[model samples]
Structure formats: C-alpha cells, structure tokens
Target: MKPIYSRIVATGGYLPERILSNRDLEQMVETSDAWIFARTGIRSRHIAAPGEKTVDMAEAAARQALADAGLNAADLDLIIVATTTPDQIFPSTACLLQARLGNRGAPAFDIQAVCTGFIYALATADRFIRSGGARHALVVGVESMSHIVDWTDRGTCILFGDGAGAVVLSAGDQPGIISTHIHADGAYADLLQVPGGETRIAMQGNAVFRVAVRTLGEIVQETLAANALTPAEIDWLVPHQANIRIIEATADKLGLPMERVVTTVEHHGNTSAASVPLALDEAARRGCFQPRQRLLLEAFGGGFTWGSALLRWG
Candidate 1:
C-alpha cells in the first residue's frame, strides 16, 4: 500500500530590508530598468543585510511558518532547505538553521537543485511524512544570490535577488499532494549556472530562456494528466519567478489565462529557490488559497532542473 502524507499546515516568507531596483542596477551597470522590466517583469528585489546569511533568513521564515501552524521548533521532526547558495560549503545550511531554531534533534540537510528547489524540498518532505519517518517537516527555500552575482555583468546581475520562504507540513490523511513530476536535461546545464568560487554566478541568458519555456510546458501537461485533472480544475498556477516571459509562456501553453497565474516577479524578482514558496505564502496570506483549492506549482532553474506539483490545500 502507498503511504499517505499530510497537508502543509502553514506558510510564511521573509525578505531582506534592502530593495535593489532595476534603476539601481542601471546606475551600477549598462542596462536600463525598462529593458530589465520588459524582459523579466522585475522592477525591484531584496538584498540581505550586511553579515546576514542564508541560514539566518531561513530560520526567520521557519519561525513564522511554525507560528502560523500553531507549532513550535520542539515539535519539528525534519528540516529541509532548498538552496544553491548555502551559508558554507559544509555543515549544510538546513542543519545550521535547525541549530539556530532551537531544534537540536531534528534531522536537517540541504538540497541544491537551483530554482526548482522548493518543489524538490516539498517532495522530499512529503515522502518522509508518507513513510512515517517524520510527523512535521520544515521546508525552506532560501538564497542569497545577490552576494554571488557578478555585478559588473549586466546580463546576469540585474536578474536575481535574495530572500527566503518556508512552509510547515504536518501529517494528515487529506488530499495534500495529489501528484508531482520532476525532470532535468543536464545537457543544457551550462546554459544558466554559476561556474565557480562556490559563489559567483555564470550564465548564458538567451539559451536558458528557450529551454525553460519548453520544459515547463511539457512537464506541466504530464503532471496534470497524471492527476486526472484539467487546466480548468486548477484554482491557481504558480511558476518559478525567473522571468515574466517564461511565466507567460507556461501559462499560455497550459491554456490558463494570465489572471489565474500568481505572480510576484514584478516585486520580488527572480529569488531563485525562494520564489515559489514566497509567492505561495503571499497568496495564502491574501486569502487567495481556500481550503481544498487546487494549486499547480512549477519551477525551472540551474541544473536545468524543473518540477511540478498538484495539490489541494488542506
């Protein structure tokens, strides 16, 4: 028999104080805000305070998610952090977050799937919950991409921002995750990837843009068909906040109108791993996601990783 898992009880997000607008980038580089906004739909993005690390932002978001779920750190059984830019090369940022959150016993680790991170982490948490290894899991998608971008390169620097978002998943027998689909085409890995220093970002913008649109549409159709659902049954469609064009293409291919797509790219920019969860939390807070609401979430990023999940919020 297939094991059953629970619903995500609560969601929360935390953004840094510094807001870097495309205008700000224009002053620093050769690009204009209009070009950036027209292409990516990103006007501004947040930057972590001096000395703030990925773990710090993850902890803050996790705390809020816990509070929203009416649970505490002591109650958590697992913590999974989805990030490409971790606080360090070792010790895993998820473990650091667990230590900081006052949860000494929970098993914590980090996953590096670039932008599709939250969906990857969510699936991991769901499996653990299903297998009866964990009762409550904290899944956080945090990134400090601002610290790593080559600010001198207008092509990449103007496209990313930093932030974190978290969700608290608890055990239940309701329809939470109906179906999930994950895909990767490593042949295009170099299309958009940070090449070195374990810090700096390296990317080929044009090529990655084309692949993202194609893969997102294909995987979304596969996910919907597997779940026995149709585009009309979806209450909301949330795509990775990489670029507005990417989101629009994905929505169009799925036959969903732009109005039905939840977007925060105009305000948050491409927050990488944090984008999806941050959008979800913001929508949940605004009362957009009702109980039993069907939401389809998708993301694509470095590693050429992409994933989709169909869920009915419990």
Candidate 2:
C-alpha cells in the first residue's frame, strides 16, 4: 500500500471591517504612528464590531474555504479550530463552527498553542489523514484578540488584531505537507502572556524578541535539514504575522528575499493563531503560489510555543 498525504485543497480568510490605525492608537494612548511603525511595522489592523465574535469570523473563513474547494460541510471527516478567544467555555469553537456549517459528528475540537496553533492543527489533520482516520479535514485559525487587548497598554494593544483564516485538506497519493515541527517551553510563558486574573495582554517585549529570534532561526534550520533541502529551495516564507523584526530574521535564515515572504503584519498585526493562515490565504488569493513550488510556514507565540510546516503548492 502506498502512503497517504494530506493536501491543501483550498484556503480562506476574513477580517473585520472596522479599521484601527496607529493614528487612532495615538489618540487612545501616548504613542505616535511613526514610533509604532518603526518598532512593529504595523500601520493598522481590523477590529471586530461589538456584535462580532470569534465563531462568526471562523464561519466566514470556513465557508469561503469550503466554497473555494468545491466541498460541502458534510464532506469533512474532521473539524479543528485553533483559537484563543472562543465564544464559549463549555463548547469548543470547533463544535460551534461545525454546527454553523451544519457538519454533524466529525469529531470537532480546538487546539490552543497561541500563534503556533494553526501549524499544530494542520499537522494533526495531516497525521489523521495519513492514518486513514479521515479523508478530509477543515482546519481553522481564528482569534478575537481585540476583545482581550488592553486599550490603554500600548505595548501589547498595538501588536494584536482580530481575524480568522481557514484551509480545506484532502488525502492524496503525493505529499502536500512535506513536514511539520512544533515545540513549546512553558518556562518562558510569563515573558508574554495575559496574566491569570487579567483579560489584557502583558509582555516583556525585549525578552520575548530575543527568544523568538533564536528559536525561529533554529527551527528554520531544523525544517530544512529534515527535508534535506536548503534555504534557497524555499519559494516562499508564509510566517506568523507578528513583529517585523522576527519575520525578517526568519527570512534572513532562509536567505529568501523580502518579496518572497508573505507579510501582513503592517495591516493585520498579530492575529495569534490566525496569522499564518491569514497570510497564506491572502497570498494564495493573489495567485502568488505556483504548482510544485515549496513554501515554508512558521510561527512563534506565547507558551514560548513555536512551529514550522513545509509544503508544496499544487
């Protein structure tokens, strides 16, 4: 018997309509657009409206992905969501999404790895498809970061946004996902986390930056080595839309030019788990990927969590 691999059939993303610009933040806090832009390369990000929720964004993205793949909700063998801010505590966001899409009993659940979440979920879907546990899966990364951001805390507030991104995958003879690597260290969680009693994000920016640069660089090498490939072989770097500096360091490690990297931080900020998928969907919609081209996806987030996925475009 031949091995089965999971291939990405389609992708989708959704961002709230309300635009929150750095200038607006300046008014809300004591920060200027130039200062924020120089530090984070973020000009603006979308904020969900009062009535909007994480599941709503997830549904929109999931529906778009299903439509793009020409698949119905019933076709999915599994449903997985990677989200930090779910609509409810009891029901997993995946269940809520499955209900919205009218998909019944497909073993829906959620994964919480912060920014590395989508990568983890994608890897899980890949493994399930390979093991013959499922033929098709829907993986979604959605976050309502705006809901938890402390408007007064410019340090963390300017670094996050709310959005969702999704992908549809199917089992195939050839590999769509070449490899996936995920890791975490809870010891560094305090460096970047929303404290137990607080809803707002708190972070030691400098500390997090140092660790991110090192870990991300190490993973780039790990991914390439595992696949017996080199930095120059990667066609694109679809990274978590976090800080510009971290993205740059990863790009440098891959030796890929800026144009070859898919970056949405300037417009999307850090949508946590939604970052990579959102960037991927944006570039895919723009016809940026070509068949057989190699693409590298990576993310580093709170929990000191980080991961990478290598894939071929088809």
Candidate 3:
C-alpha cells in the first residue's frame, strides 16, 4: 500500500480594503517613506476595518480556498488556524472559523507559533493526514496585526499589517508536502513579541533581524537535506513576507535569485502568520506556479519561532 501524503489542492488569500501607505504612517508616526521602504521593503499595507475580526478574514480566505479546491466545508476532516491575535482568548480562532464555514466535529484548533504559525499548522495537518486521522484539512493563517501595533511606536508600528491566507490539503498517493522543519528558542522570545494580555507589540529589531536571517537559512538547508534535494532544485521560494532583506538573504543562501522568490511585503508588509500563504496564493493566482514544480516555503516570527516546508506544487 502506498503512503498517504497531504498535498495542497488549492490556495486563497484575503486582504482588507483599507490601505495604509508609508506616507500615511509619516502623518501618524515620526518616519519617512524612504526609511520604511529602505529597511523593510514595505510601502503600503492593508488595515482591517473596525470590527473586522481575525475569524472574518480567515473565513473569507478559507471559503476561497474551498472553492478553488472544488471542495466544501463538509469535506474537511480537520481545521487548523494559526494566529496570535485571535478575536478572543476563550474560543480558539479555529472554532470560530469552523462555525463561520459551517464545519463541525472535525477537530478544529489553533496554533500560536506567531509568524511561523502557518508552517506549524501545515505540518500538524500533514501529520493527521499521514496518520490516517484525516483526509482533507483546511489550514489557515490569519491575523489582525494592525490592532496590536502601537501606533505611537514608530519602530514596530510601521512593520505590520492585516490579512489572511489559506490552503486546502487533501490525502493523495503522490508526494505533496515533501518535508517540514520547525525550530524555536524561547530565550529569544523577547526579541519579538507582544506582552501577555496587551494589544501593543514590541521588538528588538536588530536582534531579531540577525537571528531570523541565520536561523531561516539553516532551516531551509535542513528541509532540503531531509528531502534529499538542494536549493538549486527548488523552482520557487515562497518565503515569509517579513522583510524584503530577510527574504533576499534567505534566497541568497539558497543560491537562488530574487526573481525566484514570491514576495508581497512591498504591498502587504508583514501580515504575521498570514504572510507565507498570502504570498503563495498571490503567486498561484497569477499563474506563477506550474503543476509538480518544487516549491520551498519558510517563515520566522515572534516566538523566536521559524520553520520551512518543501512541497510539490499542484
């Protein structure tokens, strides 16, 4: 009998209508557009409307993914939503998203690995599928990061945005998610995080930048090794939309050029957990990916968490 592999059947993404440009931040904070763009490669980002919850964005992305996959909520045997800024602390965002998608009794939950969350959630769902516990899974990375940004803190305020991205993974005989690698160091948690029960986010930019570039490069190599492949074998690099510099550094480490990387940071900023899948969906929609192409996905985020996933595009 062949092993069941979880493959991404379809992808989808959603960004709120409100656009917050760098100039807008200039009016609100003490920063220039050139400075923000030069450092983070972000010129504009989306801001969710007041009352727009994380679950709302998750549902929108999930629905689009379901439609793209030609599957419905009923087909999903599992649902995992990766987020740090959930609507409430009581019910997990996964449960809220399930309710909104009209899905029930499929082991819905949330993963909080901060920005590496989508990769974490994707890995978890893959395990369930490989273990025969599930056949179809909905993995979503959604965040209302704008709500957590300290508008007064120019450093952190200029870096985050709001959005959601999702993928439908289903059991198959072919290789789908080839491999995944995840790592974390709580000692560095202070480098990037939001204090408990607080809406404001804080970070040691320089510290996080150095560590993210190093760790992300290491994990990408780990993932490639696990799959017995090399950076040159990857057709596309779908990286976390944290910063263009970080993305470029990772690509450089992989011996790949910037053109091979799927980046949305210039327009989307850092949507936290939503970054990777959002970029994936955008690339997929634009017909940038070909069936059976080798793709590498990676992310680094707040828990001082980071990970990578290698997959065959479908």
Candidate number with the higher TM-score (1 or 3): 3
Residues 1-314 of candidate 3 have per-residue lDDT tens digits of 88999999999899999999999999998999999999999999999999999999999999999999999899899999999889998699999889998987899999999999999999999999999999999999999998888999999989999999999999999999999888888999777878887779989999999999999989988988888887789999999999999999999999998888999999999999999999999999999999999999999998789998899999
Top lDDT: which candidate number? 2
Per-model TM-score versus the true fold: 0.97, 0.99, 0.99
lDDT of 2 at 86: 92
Give Cα-based local distance difference scores for all models: 0.89, 0.94, 0.94
lDDT string for model 1 (1-314, tens) is: 65576688999899999999888888899999889888889899999999999988998899999999999899999999999889788899988998888898889999889999899999989889988999999999999998888889988888889999999989877668777788777888777776664567888888888888888989888998897778788889978899999999988887888878999999898999999999999988988878998899999988889999888886
The weakest ten consecutive residues by lDDT in model 1 span 190-199
Question: What TM-score does candidate 3 reach?
Answer: 0.99
Worst 10 residues of 2 by lDDT: 193-202
The residue ranges of model 2 lying beyond 4 angstroms of the native Cα positions read: none
RMSD (CA, Å), each prediction: 1.3, 0.6, 0.8
Q: Which digits, one per residue and each the tens of the lDDT, describe model 2 over residues 1-314? A: 99999999999999999999999998899999999999999999999999899999999999999999999999999999999899889599999999999998799999999999999999999999999999999999999999888899888888899999999999999989999999999999789888887888888999999999999999999999999998889999999999998899889888899999999999999999999999999999999999989999999989989999999987
